[model samples]
Target chain A: MKEKLCSLQEAVATYVHDGDVVAIGGVGRNRAPMALVREVIRQGKKNLHIVGREKGMEFDMLIGAGCVKKVSFALVSLEEFGLAMNFRRKAQAGEIELDEHACNSVITSLRAASMGLPFLPLRGMFGSGVFEVSKNLKEIECPFTGERLAAVRAIKPNVTLIHAHQADKYGNVRIMGSPFEDILKAWAAEKTIVTVEEIIDNDEIRNNPQLTSIPYIYIDAVVHQPKGAWPASCDSYYDSDIEEIKAYAQAIKSPEGFQEYLEQRVLSRRD
Target chain B: MAEYTTAELMAVCLAREISDGDRVLQGLYSPLPMMACLLAKRFHAPNMTYFNTADVIDPEPKKVPFSTAGPALQERAVTYIPLWQTFDLAQRGELDLIFLGAAQVDKHGNTNLSAIGPYEKPKVRLPGGAASAHLCAIMDTVIWIPRHNNRVLVEKVDFITGQGYLSGGDAREKAGIPKGGPRKVVTNLCIMDFEPETKAMRLVSLHPGVSLEQVKEATGFELIIPSEVKETEPPSPEELEFMREIDPKGVRELEFH
Candidate 1:
């Protein structure tokens, strides 16, 4: 085991690489891994793909930092903070491949990945336009239903980055607010990087099993990073810093402003 | 005239309309109307049965957020009814009323949820038909509300989320729908019903203080406003208080949708 103070660059370099599908946990403004994402951006990994329901600063940084090549999201806006200009403009401009979606599609997609099944069977989509949107989506016969169903396929990512409330040095993490579908992402990935706001002893978390969100067995590295979910919340630990989020929103509205943001927070950082 | 945001108006709508005597079902994230149903039951509908044809309807109410439950909702509540049950309820004609929102609706009540742009790749994508398509096929009555304007009340939906007003006379029966579809559309601006022949949405009523032209301006589709259009009744003082105070979290809608 190695113990050393790591910059954001060193921290992100520990998990990500090119051509990886990343499963992220966070909805609206709760439970995100912003610091880790900042590290990923600062390190400049490439050809990344992301899957999730809500797209927060993590998605923004990935795209803005020129690391992401594709994204599949249920809903990727800031909700009330404003629309997602980086993702929206990038998708519209074709800089990144976008799969704009609904819950059934994303959740089914994740489930299929976990089951190692080729497709997911569902009712009510024979003639609907979703058939077209998902035309490229693999279609197959549901083994049990015998009816034709769509397979979301296994989306094993190279890494899954998550921020939670507490963790032991061994990587067992506890998430307080919303887990969104993170456990599946962990199972669907090759490796995981768990960062936490607090670092507790493994024995303590082991004694009380209910507090655990990520069991240590699946985790690769455990990093103690407070305010790790900077733009988002860590639940019982911290709330979203709306002021910083507001500033990020203001910057992403224009390319010039976004570039400035990248330079100031991303490029300027030693990490 | 009050300071009720769009969200508050939606809460009031749920509280006043849904009754305890009737079982209520709603869509997820459909905050205002769902709240309105709870209030209506708490105040009016006393014995109403609640159902969520989509997700598990959690009655405990604390862990689930006011708007929509995250993954944690599964932890607290038992998965109760399947969507087919709501369809069954509508099929048996047991449903007193059901509320839903629409992308676009035309005269004679043809609603679209297919594409926001062309049929190929739409500009905007919404959560596809929940029970709208089937509900239209069998429901005794359905209320369509769109929070936004003109783009929604178009002469045609870039896509149809659900097929509405299949046929006023007997076309629905012939098509296999026991009951005809679509009773009314409650929008942010005003209310509308179907015409006799064309079956297009006719302006039937407006929210309090809304004008005829204002409703007309918001509609992309041509509408027939009845000579005598009424206003949606305002929330009673009691309804307002319950919504703002007791159910501020918007739980009334969460359990059923």
Candidate 2:
């Protein structure tokens, strides 16, 4: 088996490129691959197309750092802290292209990619204003039932980034709780880079193979980074750092403050 | 009558929407619905299958977490159901109830959580609606607007993130939605329901101390007020106590602010 373990900087630099389509792991503030995301920003990658369902700070920070030019997502918010200010500001200013979708459509699109299909039929979003702005969605009649369904175009991201609780050197990953679309994302993307809290022995992974969420076949690189999902909870590892998130939210209220935040928190960090 | 905060009253009203065996799902940033679900399960709807954005099934959290998607919800769950599977349940017409917050709501019941001004160039890009489009068509959607004002209760939304009665009577049906749409809209001031004939938002009941003139003044669009409007029942002592028991830190009040 090929040893897929590498440093975070090398993994991101080699796989993630300028203007590549990227899908981030985690939902909201849970198990976000912050370390990998920060590295992508740190490397000064630009014009990347980000895709996800119900993203939060991960997507917001990327947009804040000006790394993203377009986003195809269902929702992006900081939950209780309020709207993702950076996303709201950039979007309001028409700085980023929005391929806004309903959450179901995003899921169906990823599913289509995972299945190697051109598109998948969705049941809802017919009269929704989201159906109006979504350029990739089309109305198709089911051949058998003659039912009108929304056909969501498949989204195959160039690289998928994920954070897992544990993994082996060969990249058999075990996500502790709520593997929110991470598995589907890995299967849909051309390459997948997982940052893990710890890299365990391959024998241990093989001992309990059923616990492995994503097998070595799907993963391209595995970067062992402790506290990879910092500020976000890792489920059974640590709770979300609400104060830090709140402070970050406050810091990004202005464009100058957002840049200052990047300098102090994200850009200043060493790999 | 028992003394209660507006948040407590809203939570109790939302809790009453659940039946014994309804399969309900709560979304992210929904502290009020989270409290309501716990209160319902503990009281009337013990058999209802509760699900959250965290993918936990029938979670028995000791206390409501600050974030609705927190790990506390996963602590004592019966099992796990990924979001796709939950969406599948809604598509299959098995999921009964869901609560969604709206940035703006029209008289036709169409909600906009997308953008305030226009799609191409928005004045304020609100948080995109998560699963509202799909689930609002299939599940019995209960919308909550914490701040009831002219800005929120618009005559027509700029964008329809969630399909309600789409331009009124039979429009939702013509759109080929499988089943279910907006059932009841609970706000801080009053409870509103759709008029059966016109599918327009109609004032049903007002919360205690909230006047008919106040609701009329707050709504941007003309509401179909019936000949008589009832006052919303205040939270009972038992309900208020149970609400405190579930959310002692008053997380339910977070959205109201």
Candidate 3:
């Protein structure tokens, strides 16, 4: 196997391209690939179509930085702090395209891509207005039972970005807790780039093979960055830096403030 | 009656709804419901299976974490169930109850967490509904609206992010939904349930100090008052003590603030 270890900048630069459909791995406020996301912002990648299940700071920051042209998501918000100001602002202003989906639809779509299917049958969202607005979903009657089902189109992203607890140089990853759709995203995407908190020996990963969430075959690149998911919890590693998150939430209230946030928090960082 | 915050009162009321052996799930940004589930597990419904947005199954966290979607929930968790699997459980009909938050809710309990005005050009682009659309259709949903006013309680939602009774009477069934819809709506001011035939929101009970006139004034649509609306029970002293023990930092009050 080719050694996939590389720097965050190189991994993002090489794998993530302009206008590529990028899948974000983590769920809300936990294990987001922030270091990789910041590099994507700093590199000035544009017009990316972002996808995620339940997103938070990473998606909001990407939108605020004007890197995203369209977003396909079930939900994106700052949770307790408030609404994702940038997303709310840009969406209401019609600056970005919103392909709204229910959470299950996104999962089912990704699952379809993972399984190499054109579309997958889903149980719900038939009567809700979300079903009406979602252009990718179709209602189909099951042939065997004549039961109604929503068919969600497969979403095969060009790249999937993930943050995990540990990995080997060859890209065998160990996600400590709650591998929230990261493995599915990896399988669904053409290329998977992982940013891990630590790089361990291959023997350590080999010793406990069952702990390896994403094997080397699926991962295209592995970026080793400690505290990569700062302001977002990494399970056993550390708790979320709520103070910094609050600071970020406070800073992005205005356009100028958002730029300043990008400069000081995102762009200025060297890792 | 013991002195209790509205948050505490709401938590107790929500806990009362959980029955033994019921499989309950709570999504992100939901401290009150989290507290209620924990409270229920500790008190009445020990056999109830609990799930959170953090993907931890039956977590016994020390205290309610500031962010519901974080590592704190993983502490002493029985097992891990990722978002997909949890939704799968709902699809398989194993999930008994779900607590969902709404941005705007209508008389029929149709929720709008999608947008305020229009799909393309929204007046206000609220957070898109995560699993509300799917779960509300498949399983029992207990909606919690932190703020109760004319703006939130509407005649018709601008968009239905979650299907409730749809247009009322046989609408959900006609739409091919097999089971489950919004069961009850719990708000800061009062508790509301759907009328059996019309499926419109009806006044169930008023919270301790809130009045019938106040509820009528706050609601955007005319509510079906049942002539005798009882005052919602205040949180018991034992309940208050246990709630304080669970949430020493008052994390549950953050939503109210």
Candidate 4:
């Protein structure tokens, strides 16, 4: 088996190119690859398009860093804290293109991409006004029943990044809790990078076959970085830093505070 | 008189709306409904199947979850799902009830969670439609508003994130949407229900200290107020105690504040 281990910076630099369409795997605040995302920002890549099913801090941080040009997702709020400040401001300022899709439609697009299909038929958008705005959505009549269905375009991202609980030396990933589109995202993308909380022996993976959510063949690279999902919860490991997130929400409201946050938190990284 | 906070009142009102054996679902930023669904499951509707948006099924968290999407909800789950499966269940019509919040809602029950001002250029770019637009057309949705004011209760939403009763009765059916639609709108001020014939919002009851004039003044559109509107019943002592036990740390306070 090929050795796929790498440093967070090396992994990001090798896989995430500027203007590349990138899909990230996490829901709300669960187990996000913030370390890798921060590194992407540190590399100062521009015009990146982000594909997320559900996100919060990671996307907001990336947007605030002036890295994103377009975003396609169901929702991107800080949950209990408040709205995603940078995402909201940048979008309202017309600095980034917001391709809004319902959470289900985004998932359907990923499913289609994973299945290598052209499009997926869905029933949710029949009468909804979303079709009027989202040009990529089309109303097609089912050939068999003549029923109108929304044909959501497939989402095949150039690269996908995910944070897992554990991975083996050969890159088999074990996601303890709800996989939440991470596996599907990995399958759909052209390249897959995983940031894990721990790098365990292959025997541990072999000993527990059922916990293997992503097989080694699918993963392109693996970076062992504990607390990779910091500020966000990583299931069994730690809970989300609600206070810090709330503080970030308040701090990012002002330009000076946001800059200070970047200086203290992002720019002054030890590793 | 036993005093109750607005959060407790809202959660209790939402709990009553749930029926026995209903397959209910709730998303992120919804603490009231999470508590209500759990309360309903514990007391009135034990058989109610609950989805906590954390992908957990019937999550019996020892403590109140800080956020609905947090991992704490899955502490003692019977089973769980991938986030995609939640939508799959909604699309297949397996989900019976869902709780939603609206940035703006109209008399016709049309809802907007997408943008505040306009689609392309918004005064405030609210979070885009996650599952609101799609789920509302399929399931029996209940709208919850944290604050009730004229801006939120508009005559017509700027963007329709979820289709309530579009124009009126039969409009949803005419538009090829599924039969079930929005059933209620629970807010801090009062509980409102949709009219059977017109599909317009009608004031059912007002919370304690909330006057009829206040509700009327707060609503942007004209409401169908009954001649003898009743005061909303306060939460029972037992329900309040149970809620306290469920959310001992008062996680619901974070939103109301």
Who is ahead in TM-score, 1 or 2? 2
A1-271: candidate 2 lDDT, tens digit per residue: 7999999999999999999999999989998999999999999999999999999999999999999999999899999887799999999888999998988889889999999999998888889888866889999999999989889999999999999999999989999899989999999999999999988999898889989999999999999999999998898899899999998888888889889989989899874
- The predictions' CA RMSDs to the true structure, in order, are 6.6, 1.1, 1.0, 1.3
**Local accuracy of candidate 2 as per-residue lDDT tens digits, B1-257:** 67889899999889989999999999988998998898899889999999998888999988788878888988799887789999998888889999999999999888999988878888889989988987877768999999999999999999899999999998988988847889899999999999987899999899999999999999999999999999998888988888888788889999877
Cα lDDT of model 1 by residue, A68-126, tens digit: 89887645655445556777666656687765434445655666667767555433223
DockQ for the candidates, in order: 0.15, 0.82, 0.88, 0.75
Tell me the tens digit of each residue's lDDT in model 1 across B76-95: 43444434344445556676
DockQ of 4: 0.75
Worst 10 residues of 3 chain B by lDDT: B62-71
Q: Once superposed on the true structure, which residue ranges of model 1 sit more than 4 Å away at CA?
A: A1-8, A135-149, B1-7, B14-148, B159-185, B192-204, B224-230, B242-257
For residues B19-73, write the lDDT of model 4, one tens digit per residue: 9998888787788888999889988999998887788898888887786878888
Give model 3's DockQ, 2 decimals: 0.88
TM-score of each candidate structure, all chains considered together: 0.74, 0.98, 0.99, 0.98
* Model 2 segments more than 4 A misplaced: none
TM-score of chain A of each: 0.89, 0.99, 0.98, 0.97
lDDT of each: 0.61, 0.91, 0.91, 0.87
